[model samples]
Every structure is written in C-alpha cells, then in structure tokens.
Target: MKKSLVLAMVLAGFAATSFAAEPAFLADRHVARGASCESCHGVKAPAPGAKVSSTACMNCHGSLDKVAERTKAKVPNPHYNHLIGTDCQECHKGHAQSVNLCGSCHNLDWKVP
Candidate 1:
C-alpha cells in the first residue's frame, strides 16, 4: 500500500477504536478511594467483561447485613430485597451505568448509584 494510504488506515483505526472503547465509568469512584483493578478484581489484569464476585465486593464493603443496614432508611431496602442473595453485579456495573434491578418489576423510585 502507498505510504499515504497506510497512514490514513492507521488514523482511521485509531478513531474507530476511540469511539468503540468507552471510559471506565466506575474506575474513578473506587480508584479515588485508593482502590486498584487488582484490589477489586483480585487480578493484575481482569479479562474484558470479567465479573468481580460478591465475595470480592464484601471484602471491602462488609457483609450483606451491613449493606442492608446502610440502606435501612430507604424503604424496601435493595440489599434486603426478595432477591437477597443475588450477585452484586446484577445491579452494579463497574464500567457501565448501575441499574436498580428492583425497579425492573416494580415501579420503585430508586437510583442505583
């Protein structure tokens, strides 16, 4: 390929990649509090779309009871819901927007931030 064509292809590749890869949305929240990828994921490099277990989350966030207590004031506590033992990742997306799974079925006015 001509040099100009090769250069154009490289630049196009970079632009495509930039649009495809979103910023790690939740990284700043935990990283600012002295957490790293290894600290949370328990690996130096967690594979793309790899899930961090609830056990890993509880390590720093305490038990389910503790989480429920923290949200005690919120009526129909999310942590103490019918889906009590659900994995933390169900509603908590590390790199994407967090969701209120409870609101999926019910018309609850809760935000999962």
Candidate 2:
C-alpha cells in the first residue's frame, strides 16, 4: 500500500508538471487578436502533446514559395537557405520563444520573434 501511494504521488506530480508546461492559449497574442484554436490546431483539439502541423500554419500565412520570394533579397535568405527546410515551427513557436535555427551554424544576427 505504501509503495502504491508513493507511485500515485509521483505520477500526479508528473502530470501536473506536463500540463503546466503547455502554454495558455488565451494568453497568446494571436488568440487575443481573434485567432481560435482551430486557426492552427485544425477542427479538433489535438491529443495531449500533439503538435500543430506546418501546413495548418501555412494556410493563413503563405506557402513556402511565397515566403521564399518575399525574403529572397536578404543575404542568405532565412526561408529558402535554412538547413531545416520550410517547417515554420522549427524556428517559430506561437506560444513559446522562437529560435533562430541559423544560429546553430552561422553567426548571422537575425531577430526571431
């Protein structure tokens, strides 16, 4: 019984931490601007820990071709010259800090929001 109690407590703690780590949707600026969960997450709420696909984001944002054209002038255009291809989530996070994937190899100072 004691072992079971301890295991239950541990599991509960892990569950709490996992939920806490997920960003609050309402607090996101995009959501405040009237973007719903479906705007990025599709029609259904994703299973716990499921990610929003790049295609969903591109639906509102633009296709990879459009993005590449817009940023073509930038030296080493981030969109087209990226090591990870056109997966926006690789650098952008709607509810978290965006990373500069280029920083992994190049020292370019790009401001990633």
Candidate 3:
C-alpha cells in the first residue's frame, strides 16, 4: 500500500512539472507583438486536445497562392506541389519546431524554419 501511494505521488509530481514546463504560444514573435490565442485558436483556452485549423493561419498569412508566390524565387514551393494540400500546421507549427512535410516523401533539401 505504501509503495503504491508513493508511486502515485511521484507520477502526479511529474505530470505537474510537465504541464508547467510547456512553452506558451505568447512566446512567439507574432503573439508577443499583439496576437492572442483568439487570433489563432479563437478561444482563451482551446478545449482539451483541440487543434487550430489551417484557415485560422491563412486569415493572417494570406492564401496559399500568396505564400507560393512570395517563396517562389527563394525556395522550392512546398505550398504548390504539396501532396497533403495547404494545411499550414503540418509544417508551420507556431509554438513548436516547424517541419517540412515534403521531407516525409521527397528528398527535397528545403529547410523549413
């Protein structure tokens, strides 16, 4: 009984620490400037396990056409020939490391940051 109780306390402490260490979205430059959770999430706090939609990002970042055009000269267009369409969050995570979704299938050496 003591062992079980001790284990539960340790697990609870670890869970609390993990939650406290989570990075805040407000740490991002866009959010620091003026953007709020509502800007992307449309709520003060999203429901547990809720996800922000691509449209929420597009509202500020503009359409896929605009993104493709802007990046056409500098880099290979991830937006244009994407197999998964323009779900920006697939590569453009605001609060975490951005990934190049194209890297999953193609060997394109494009650096997505």
Candidate 1 clashing pairs?
none
- Specify the highest-lDDT model's number: 1
> Tens digits of per-residue lDDT for model 1 on 17-96?
87556344565577767799987789989998788889988998899999999999998889997799999888887878
lDDT of each structure? 0.84, 0.73, 0.73
Residue 1's lDDT in candidate 1? 81
Best-to-worst order by TM-score is: 1, 3, 2
Candidate 2 lDDT, 1-113, residue by residue in tens:
69999999999999998766654432275665777888888865756666778898778768877877888888888877636365777777766677788877888888765
lDDT of candidate 2 vs native? 0.73
| TM-score of candidate 1 to 2 decimals | 0.75
lDDT of 1: 0.84
Residue pairs in candidate 2 whose N, alpha carbon or C atoms collide under 3 angstroms: none
Off by over 4 Å in 2: 1-27, 82-86
Q: Please give the ranking of all candidate structures by lDDT, highest first, separated by commas.
A: 1, 2, 3
TM-score against native, each model = 0.75, 0.65, 0.66
Name the runs in model 3 displaced over 4 angstroms.
Answer: 1-27, 82-84
